[model samples]
Target: MTTEKLVSEIRKKHSFLCVGLDVDLDKIPSFLLNEEDPIFSFNKAIIDATHQFAVAYKPNTAFYEAYGIQGWKSLEKTIKYLNENYPEVFTIADAKRGDIGNTSSRYAKAFFEDLGFDSVTVAPYMGKDSVEPFLNFKDKHTILLALTSNEGAFDFQTKKVEDDEVYKHVLKTSKNWKNSENLMYVIGATKAEYLAEVRNIVPKSFLLVPGVGAQGGSLTEVCKYGMAENIGLLINSSRGIIYASQEANFAEVAAKQAEKMQLEMKTILDGIH
Candidate 1:
């Protein structure tokens, strides 16, 4: 989906929420295991229940990859279901893949052409050559890791490189890459304070922010500094929403959790206008 269309969906739904389909079999209700494909079954239920309240759905690749071939099948089914049923909802493959130019191109093709994801998460440690391949795919976004929502982020992201923080350098330098307009970024909600400085570097790029509910990040603080005129933030909630309840009524409970965030987002959008 185009950035404009994504923004349009955010406005139409009064939400920038991106539900994370980071399904772990151990965490999901055991009843789903009886189904032919437990992972896909669980994802379908959650997507159906929460799609209305969310503008995007991100399925972290690790969850599926851990299960091997069956996991890959489940992931394929999940994305196919979304594309067929809810084409308006943006899909992100949280793969965090980066490699040599030739290798990165294959990875890009796997997610963008074969898997049909609207965007894919990528690591930037390998520099422009590794990421430029992914950016070349028209209409597909390459969301580079900038400031993450993990305890280890301080190990390098916040460390000063000359005068500016390392992540700030990543944000500034990425703009010069090929097809950079298609680039988005991952900025953890936990580091909301750094958002103002982040925005000053790339005022228009979209940010896929994780670490909200489960991680105790402040949604209000994130928006206060990170929100752009277009509301360029896709706040994700995984465990907090999908695992709201592991009972038979899991989908219903997930919907309720999503609705709560959607309502808050609507209020924020209202104030923006």
Candidate 2:
């Protein structure tokens, strides 16, 4: 989707919520295990329940990859369902993929062309050549990893490098590449303090933030520091929402959780809109 279209949807819905489908087989309701495709069944219900509350759906590729080919098929079906049913809702493959130019091009095609995701998360460790390929796709986005939520992020992202933090450089350098206007950043909600700097570097670019509900990140702090004029934030909640209950009413509970977040987003957007 184009950046303008995405921002329009957020404004129309008064929300920038991105529900993460990080489905774990072990955690899902056991009754679903009997279904032909339990993972897809779970996802279908969650999407149906929460679609009105969210502007995006992000499926972490690892969750499906671990289940082998069958898992991958479930992912395909899940994304296809969203694209066909809710074309305005953005879709992201949280794959965190980046490699050499040629490899990145193929990865781009895989997610945007083959799978039909509106965007994909990419590791910026490999630098411009790796990320630019994904940005080249028309109307598709390349969400580069910046300040992450994990504890291990301190191992490198926060380290000073020539008078600047490493992630700071990653964000700044990434904008210089071709079609960088289509680029976005993954700034973990846990690192809300650094968002001011990240924002200064890419003021208009969207940010896909994780670690809100389950990881204890402050949504208020993230919005206060990270929000742009367009409300460029897609706060994600996986376990907290999707796994709100393990019973047959799982999807209902998940929808309620998502509704809570969407209401918060609406209030935030109200001030600026």
Candidate 3:
């Protein structure tokens, strides 16, 4: 999907919420195991229940990769279902993949062509060469990791490189890469304080923010500093929504969790308007 379309969906839905489909089999209700494909079954329910309240859905690749071939199949089914049923909902493959130029191209093809995700998260450690390959794909976004939500982010991201933080450099320098307009970023809501600096560096670029509910990141603080004129924030809530309940009524409970976030987002958007 184009960035314009994504922005339109956010406006139409009155939300910038991105539901994280980070499905953990152990955490899901055991009843789903009886289904032919438990992972896909679980994801379908979540998507059906929450799609109305969200403009995006992100499925972290590690969760599926851990389950091997079956996991991959489940992921394929999940994406196919989304593309076929809810094309307006932006899809993100939270793969965090980056490699040599040639390999990165393959990764881009896998997510953008084969699986048909609208965007994929990428790591920036390898520099421009690793990231440009993914950015080269037209209409497909490469969301680079900037300031993450994890505690380890301080190990390098916040480290001063000359006068500015390293992640600031990543944000600034990445703009010069090929097809940089297609670049988005991952700025953890836990690092909300850094968002003002982030916006100053790339005012229009979209930010895929994780670490809200489950990680206790303040949604209001993130919006106060991070929100752009276009509302360029995809606030993702995974465990907090998807695992709201593990009972038979899991999907219903998930919908309520998603609705809660969407209502908050609508209020924020209203204030922005």
RMSD for each model, in Å, please? 0.5, 0.8, 0.6
lDDT (C-alpha, whole model) for all candidates: 0.96, 0.92, 0.95
- Compared with the true structure, what per-residue lDDT tens digits does model 2 show for residues 1-273? 888898999888888999999989999999999999999999999999999999999999999999999999999999999999999999999999999999999999999999999999999998889888998989999899998999999999999998889999898888789999888989998878888888898898899999987888888999999999878899998888899999999999999999999998888788766
lDDT of 3 by residue, 1-273 (tens): 899999999999999999999999899999999999999999999999999999999999999999999999999999999999999999999999999999999999999999999999999999999999898888999999999999999999999998888999999999999899999999999877889989999999999999997898999999999999888999999999999999999999999999999999999999978
Error of 3 at 185 (Å): 0.4
The top-ranked prediction according to lDDT is: 1
lDDT ranking, high to low: 1, 3, 2
lDDT of 2 at 49: 98
Error of 1 at 151 (Å): 0.6
Model 1's C-alpha root-mean-square deviation from the true structure amounts to 0.5
Task: Kindly report which residue pairs in candidate 2 clash with one another.
Answer: none
Find the number of clashing residue pairs for candidate 1.
0
Worst 10 residues of 1 by lDDT: 189-198
